[model samples]
Target: MRTAAELKYGEKGIINDIDGSHPSSRRILEVGFTPGQEIQLINMSAFRDPIAFSVRGTIIAIRKDEASCIKVL
Candidate 1:
């Protein structure tokens, strides 16, 4: 498994788990980062801080710090 942050642009993976202890985990869940969900790395900022992803049919942007806590297979 690898972290969401490790996924290159246009790559896809299934969400395996998330670090629940992370403060943003709840917000990430609410935004639909649940286990088994398929997510695609859509794009990234110039500095690669906030990355854009396609999840649950919607495109959302999340920071690298938060993405690092999301494990994907």
Candidate 2:
């Protein structure tokens, strides 16, 4: 499994598992990023700072660092 940001643009994947501890992991869950959920990499800037994605049918923008914590299948 890889991170959501690691996914190529327009790529889609199901959430497999998160490789992190509490708080950050808990924060992701609170935002609807759960195991088995679908996610898509929408867009990225030239700097590749905040990557956008569609998660649980909602468009969400997050930093690459945060996306790295999320493991995708």
On TM-score, the leading prediction is 1
Question: What lDDT does each candidate get?
Answer: 0.94, 0.84
lDDT of 1: 0.94
Question: For residues 1-73, what per-residue lDDT tens digits would candidate 1 score against the true structure?
Answer: 7999999889999999999988999999999999999999998999988999899999989999999889999
Best by lDDT: 1
- For all candidates, the clash counts are 0, 0
- Give the range where candidate 2 is weakest over 10 consecutive residues by summed lDDT: 18-27
Candidate 1, number of clashes: 0
Write model 2 residue lDDT over 3-70, tens digit each, in one string. Answer: 88699889999999876663477788888888899999888878887888899889888888888888
lDDT of 2 at 23: 46
Model 1 clash pairs?
none
